[model samples]
Target: MKVLLILADGMRPDSLTNIPQAQKLIKESAYTLSGETVSPSVTLPCHISLFHSVTPQRHGTTTNTYAPQVRPINGLCEVLKQADKKCAIFYNWEEIRDVSRPNSLAHSCFYAGRRIGYKEAGEALTADAIGYLKKYDTDFTFIYFGYPDWAGHKYGWMTEEYLQAIQSSWDNIEKLMAELGDEYTYIITADHGGHDRTHGSDMPEDMVIPVIIKGKGFDAGKILENVNIMDIAPTVTKILGVTPDEEWEGRALI
Candidate 1:
């Protein structure tokens, strides 16, 4: 099965509930608004846990700056590559470039959110991702929208700006679903949430994220339990008909 994994960085669960498109997705998917994120709930660390199916302690990256894993574990992309699945990535943040190791991706597109405003960058990245998906026989694609995180840092979580950013992200999601149709399974989640103007905390606001899965075998409108950020990789591998890496600690949602 083809998979489209969308990550809206620092998108709080509450903000997702406020969006109409997100609510509709929840109604049509197996979702959990209370999915637990790993502690030190920052962007890169949480994303590393998501891709590697391990915690920061295991991955050895507790901060935004990525360091080579002390004992490398196969990330989701690496496993998919081994299985001969074509993968692509579209992201606005440069720091996320390390999510996949060398030559793991069939295509990648990056637009710096800081150079052009985060909102504009997200729009551009989404458009590019749509174009690429239409033209390629890709098995997996990751689309990272950085606007919500940028807005959260600039205007504080739950603020008007942050809510608008969430809305904008939903608009993009709607576009993707409409264009791609139901041929692909869509997994939408956040790397982490935020509190005040910053994150990296144990507070519920920072650790609670939303995981929404729309695809075959998922019960519509079902709210899941015991889901974690680390579960994402195993779930993706399962969808692609590949074995999860032995080092991965999370179970597949399916």
Candidate 2:
């Protein structure tokens, strides 16, 4: 089965209360509101951990800066490509480009969130991603929305503005699902949550993330347990019928 990953950066599970789309997803998917992200809980490091299925200590990217891994490990895209699966990525953030190695991706689309602003970038990227998904037949695709994190940094986490960003991200999610959901299993999550105006602390607000799995294999309306961001890659590889990297520390959920 093809898998599509959608991420809303720095979104807190508690902030989904008022979003109609998000509420519908929570009731219809196998979900965990208290899934944990790797500490540092910063964007780049947590994502590296997610894709590589290991801790930042193992991957060696402790900050937003892309540090070369001393002992590199295959990420999701790399592993998928090795199995002859086509992979694509659509993202607003630039730093996240390093998550997958060169030649691993069959296609990639990026909108500069740093220059045009994350909100605008997310909007444009979502439209383009939807178009691409409708036209293409990629085995694995990842779509990233930077709005929530940018909003969290600008207006405190859980504030109206930040919640609005989360809602906006969900609007895009709903659009994609409405059109192309039955063809792909959708996995939605966050790299990290936030507190006040900043994150990276080990506080629950920063570390706890929400994970929603919606598709044929996952049980609808079921509450999941012991979920972690690193588990994502293992689960994806499992769904795609590919072997996980030997160094991965996470176990597949299904």
Candidate 3:
């Protein structure tokens, strides 16, 4: 089964209430509002844990900067590439480029949100992703929206600006789904949540995220428990019939 993984960086679980598309997915999919992210609760580290199925301590990257793994373990993209599954990525954060190894992606598009406006970058990335998905038979596609994180950092979490950003993200999600149709198993999640004006804490406001698994084989409206960021890779590999790396510490939700 093809997988479309969408991540809204620094999106809090409670903020999903303001996003109609997220609420619809939650009502129609197996989901958890209390999914746990790794310690440090930072963007790059959380993303590494999500893709590598390990903690930041294991991955040795606790900040936004990318670092080569001391003892490298295969990431989701690497494993998929080895299995000849076409993979693509569309994101605004350049730091996230480290999630996959070089040459592993069949298609990649990036727009630096820090330079251009985050909202514009997100919309353009979504449009590009939709076009690429339609043009290529990609097995896995990762689309990341960075506006929420930018809004949170600029205007604080749950503030009017942050909620507006969440709304905009949902608008993009609705557009993407409408264009892509039902050919993919869509997984929507966040790398981490934010509190006040900053994160990187162990508090629930920072560590708690939402996980929505919507597609075939998953029970609609099922409420899940004990979901972790690390579980995402295993779950995606499972859907694609690929074996998880031996070092991966998470299990498939299905």
Candidate 4:
């Protein structure tokens, strides 16, 4: 099965129900899995953990920089491509553009510079993702939206504006789902959640992330437990019948 991995950076579980479109997706097509973030809870390590199915320590990245390459020695993109599945990415964070990882392997990759509520930038990222999704006809696509997390960092997690930004993202996601139809296994999740909207530290809310799995063949109403961020890659690889590397720490939800 194809994978559409939606990374709504820094999204809290509590925010899902607050957005009508996201809420409908949660109710109709998906189930939420409780998960955690790696230490330092930042974007690079979190995303590396996601693709490699290991902690930041295992993946080798501690900060957002290109050095200290820890995890993702064998990224998900490489695995998927080896299995004859096309892969593509659309992301807003510049830190993830490293050549050592999945971003480099995408059939196409797009990024927007740092800044929250930059409507033109958001539109650019969204348009790129949609374009790649349509153009590649890939079996797997990963779309990472950074505004919610950036908003949370600047405006705090519980603020109305941050929530509103999430709502707008939901609208874009809806467009993606509608266009893609049932051809993919869509997984919507976050690198981490936060209380004061801060991560990169050990905090209960900051470490916890929400996992929503949906699409044509997944089990609806399936509530998975003990799912770590590290498990996501393995789960997706397994479902797609690809062999994940042995260094992965996560398990398939199914």
Per-residue accuracy of model 4 over 133-252 as CA lDDT, tens digit each: 776667777777788888888899968877876887787788888877777788888988767857787886788888888866566776767778888888788878888877667788
Model 1 residue 181 CA deviation (Å) reads 0.8
| Candidate 3 lDDT, 187-217, residue by residue in tens | 9999999999999999999999999998898
TM-score of each: 0.99, 0.98, 0.99, 0.90
Q: Number of clashes in every candidate structure? A: 0, 0, 0, 5
Q: Flag clash pairs in model 3.
A: none
Q: CA lDDT, every prediction?
A: 0.92, 0.93, 0.93, 0.75
Candidate 2 per-residue lDDT, tens place, 1-254, comes to 89999999999999988889988988889999999999899999999999999999999999999899999899999999989999999999998799999999989999999899888888898888888878888999999999999999999999999988998899989988997868788999999999999999999999999999998889988998999999999999999999999999998888
Model 3 scores worst on lDDT over the 10 consecutive residues at: 16-25
lDDT of 1: 0.92
Q: Which residue pairs does candidate 2 place in steric collision? A: none
Q: List the lowest-lDDT window of 10 residues for candidate 4.
A: 99-108
Which scores higher on lDDT, 2 or 3? 3
User: Where in model 4 is the C-alpha error above 4 Å?
Assistant: 70-72, 99-106, 115-118
Task: Between candidates 2 and 4, name the one with more favorable lDDT.
Answer: 2
Task: Provide the clash count, candidate 1.
Answer: 0
Over 4 Å off in model 1, which ranges? none
